[model samples]
Target: MAFVPEEDTHRSSNSTYRAVGRADQEPLLGKQLTRLPPSLQRPEDRCHATYAIFFSLGIGGLLPWNFFVTAKEYWAFKLRNCSGPASRGYPEDSDILNYFESYLAIASTAPSVLCLVANFLLVNRVPVRVRVLASLIVTLSIFVVMSVLVKVDTSSWTRGFFTVTIICMAIVSGSATIFNSSIFGLTGSFPMRNAQALISGGAMGGTVSAVASLVDLAASSDVRDSALAFFLTAVVFLGLCMGLYLLLPRLEYARFYMRPVGPVRVFSGEEELPQDSPHSPLVASRPLGSHTPPLRPILKKTAGLGFCIAYLFFITALIFPAISTNIESLHKDSGSPWTTKFFVPLTTFLLFNFADLCGRQVTAWIQVPGPNSKVLPGLSLLRTGLVPLFILCNYQPRVHLTTVVFRSDVYPVLFTCLLGLSNGYLSTLALIYGPKIVPRELAEATGVVMSFYIYIGLMLGSACSALLEHLI
Candidate 1:
């Protein structure tokens, strides 16, 4: 029996420590991790491990997608102004055909970071207000940095020379950092009941993305340059950050998810929380029925276990869309109707977002957590739904693209949209489960869970894009 922490506050992390998820999980999934391995089995250690995962995910997310895509697009520019009339570069068609992966890779990692951080916050002992403020700050900072960087010149940009245009590059990296942290805080801190409210805000944020894309596209001409674009972006981000801080509670804290489920709150006048252990860097309290002093290593290993297969999947998949964007150049240059490679993704993103929202709404309604219901048994339910998609991949094309609508890809478009929605819902549901069942010390321990499916999607999405081009 896990005991609750009456203080209901979050722990802090100045240094990376080991804190993987606990082995014990709720029933219904039949997916409980057995007694945590010797490598990781302590509460405090688990939290620390999760921190490493979150930061790593952010780093991975920062690799540029447009960097690859624009290079592919410039294939034509090179051909047009070639040194010789007889031009030779990789197949123009091949490059354009597979450009989607680049964009996918670029976009995929950021979201993973966001989800990881938000979920981390969810499970942490930090006050919800603090978490929410952090989320707000991240969101605003991203917008500001992007807007500000629009004015910078990256004529000779390279990963090695990123610091040369540090302002622009910083915005890119910072966006991932802030986004991931905020989302982790939000997801980890907000309770089961509050998911939809948080999601509703996310849905609105998508609208902002749509608007930003439009504003950006409209402003770009023959030259893809904006003078105050970065400044404008920065201004918006800065203003929003201030506004966000104000909207959030001045002082608040969170209950540790790994400990036990309990109501939590905080007031304005506060500096720090009651220390979990006076000697420990972050104050930690043991739950109700545990009998053990903390072993630093034990805690760290436990946290690493949650994302076992998922983290690898994330890294591989994250680079997919960028790969797709590069492929797109091949198709676009050959006069494929889908010229810029933006239409499919923009369409996919739009459609996927709609589907994702629907899935989220469904999950929220299904797992609403009523008074009589202590836990939702739908973790397995969601997992089961995804099984067919992965298992039946070989037959997917036959079944999915049976009709002209699907072959013409209207059907695929519609189906993928639904798939996105369903996937999003499941992801949301899984995140909800990770926290609700864990004990306090491990509550905010965010592992590789969010990163797993997200990057896998990118990997698979890119693979599918490239495979289709290879096949067709």
Candidate 2:
């Protein structure tokens, strides 16, 4: 070989090593946004399409439940004679309607509680696609069955079968808990808006159901026709939810979440590993090449946030469907066969639903301060007082306040709106805030835990609403 200085040889070797390093880093550079601190990431990094998907998924999950609950007038009317002869119209069978309402309330929440509890075992352990696809299939199947049952002659299905239908519907609600957690967890890698979309979708579900109920009530001559309309609506929306979820994983943005392990960074189309919090799950010290962390540690970190999340839902469950249905109208004289203005499921319920949607959407503009903000938690606890306030709106013995305080139709509607606004705003904040306070890598697990807490609250609240039957 030609003579060459050792210095030159060493320089050449250094250049070769540098080239090798760059070549090796090329792939990881594209994959490395997780390494960057969140503040440094581009503001426009999030995929806006996911917001719509999350919202649709939310509506899909809750619409079926909302359909049954919102169409309370139709069911109460058709099934009034189940135990005996037809009990007349309007407020004639109020007692029986109240009893059935409580039963359905319990049935609605029981399965959600079960599913949320089981999520610890199912959420992280199951593959994302499997969990999502299975939940959608099961939910869609339930809607199909509901449509078929309602389409058949109401006489063929006895009260016992109606109970069975409630049980089946409850199971679908439970499946929704899983579906929600999965969707919420996936969005942890994106903007908080995506998570809020899921919640807002729930509000939208109620709104849509409310609107449909109004239409059915206006157009249908018979209660059976109303049932058919509601069930048909459910099937169509649920099918759409399924289709949207199937497309979720295929999105380039979703690739961040489809990883075998938790994502190290938020998705961004940039090169080089971004710097993140040193204590972040992505940057935290780990043994060897392991990216998966123990669930226990993640759970421990999120336990407090989970409790707050649970408490918020618990408050909502206690007041909503169960108590909201029991509030007495000031004047039962709308003359419409469907309902009075003050009726629990009428304008009052729809007001709450619409106001709730507005409250959740408000988060897109104004986020609750943070996990440490007492405002959200305080609002949740304050809702407990609404239970008694709403009870007072109805004609009840022992409480003279019932006649004095919420006597006007406007009072209950305003309170219901407030109740809904708080519910939507607080719960949405809890869900959105819970994962953020923890490591990004453990966000998926935190989401499951948060959901578990929410269902716990719902179950307890529904159960507690039963006491109101005795109290009022």
Candidate 3:
């Protein structure tokens, strides 16, 4: 007999019933399980490896999106002014900058909306690996193309070329949704911490990108070089991510996750397994279980979780890059001209990215331990009020009815930290709680739906950004 561990034997002996799973899975489960590869055979090593995969996926998925967002000051300013130092002097054309800002939000919004459609239509039909690989290829190609375009003619770029560039970025950004949604579904078979780890990795990607921008911008007097450094770094990261993903299926983690059936639930002959597991009322313990419930009930169970996820991103996209960038510089008297130049673009961006990363990590410490929390959904709703607060930070002279709170710049920075923390912690909590509350069978579907909702929020926020720009 193959050696089952003592804990496995104990659990099997005490178990009430064998996990009731799909009829097709019986033959596969009955066969002796294959031993894990030497690379990830140990439990601790497997766990570490899994965490790395989740984290890498998060970083890889979000890196391209952040590449444009973190570099907003450079591109938007250049697109409008046609050629100039991005570091100092007020934009000669504020209207053009504002127009690009609204358009930028639209670029982000449109792709996410398209992805929402793709999620329902193509996500399931397409193979997971195929979808991920295709998206990565598109993303890498976009980065390389954008880098070359900027390198060749950023100084003499016309409005027509800039519009084309935005469209290209939108295509790449929208594809991230498909990649991330697929990844979320893959993680459904794992523990909640893996989900949190994935999101934290995304925050990490944004933070690192923002830091790189600051460093690159500081190194070169010319803005074009900074822009080149930014895109080249992204290309390198994407290449590494592609390599990691290619190796994913070979890992023991992917082998385990890709199976049609999930972990075995050994039971003693005497004990009767309930038709439905208490852990997941909608279905049995394993994902491909016989006791999978109807879609309606599964949707109902996960509805709040989905709403929280959607609402969190909605608030985020609404004011973030579009409105946040418009905040006037506060420290004109700080002595250094560079401080005024980089305050909002570099300093504020870093604060939010770093704080957001910390917020996501905090969940690992203060986790509710499990998915059972009534307070979680309500928390998502309360975050909506923060939108107005962020808008209030815009401090322009003679702007009618705009509330300028603490014109000293410190106020927005603090609010930004709070915003980033709440964004990271709340969204991570919502995503983690989502799959846990449902049966294994429905967990992946639920995750896909939540991913859909996230982009929907982004879409709505993008629309709202256009409206908010008018108000400002």
Shift in Å, residue 146, candidate 3: 0.3
Q: What is the clash count of model 3?
A: 2
- Where is model 1 more than 4 Å wrong at Cα? 1-100, 103-183, 186-189, 199-207, 214-235, 251-342, 368-406, 446-472
**lDDT value, candidate 1, whole model:** 0.36
Q: What TM-scores do the predictions have?
A: 0.49, 0.80, 0.80
Global local distance difference test of model 3: 0.66
Error of 2 at 127 (Å): 1.1
Runs in model 2 lying further than 4 Å from the true structure: 1-34, 37-47, 82-96, 260-295, 333-343, 395-404
Model 3 clash pairs?
16-271, 287-440
285-395 in candidate 3: lDDT tens per residue? 433333322445546656777777778888888768777766766656676655466777554678888888998888765553223345667777788887777767644
Q: Which ten residues in a row have the lowest lDDT in candidate 3?
A: 10-19
Q: Write the per-residue lDDT of candidate 1 for residues 1-472, one digit (tens) a residue.
A: 2221313322221111112234442222222221333553223423333333322322222223223222222323332322333323434423433343333334434454555444444444455345534544554454455444444433233221223233333344334444433444344433442333344334333433433444444556522243234235434544544454443332232223223433322111222323233232222332322322232322233333224224323322322222212222223455654545454445444454456556655754453332112232333233333323322222222333332221233433444454555455545555444433333233334322433344444445444444443343
Clashes of each: 117, 8, 2
Per-residue CA lDDT of model 2 for 301-405, tens digit only, reads: 556566777787777777777766766554566665544632555655678889999988887655544455555566666777876677766643334343446
Better of 1 and 2 by TM-score: 2
Candidate 1, run of 10 with poorest lDDT: 11-20
Ranking by TM-score: 3, 2, 1
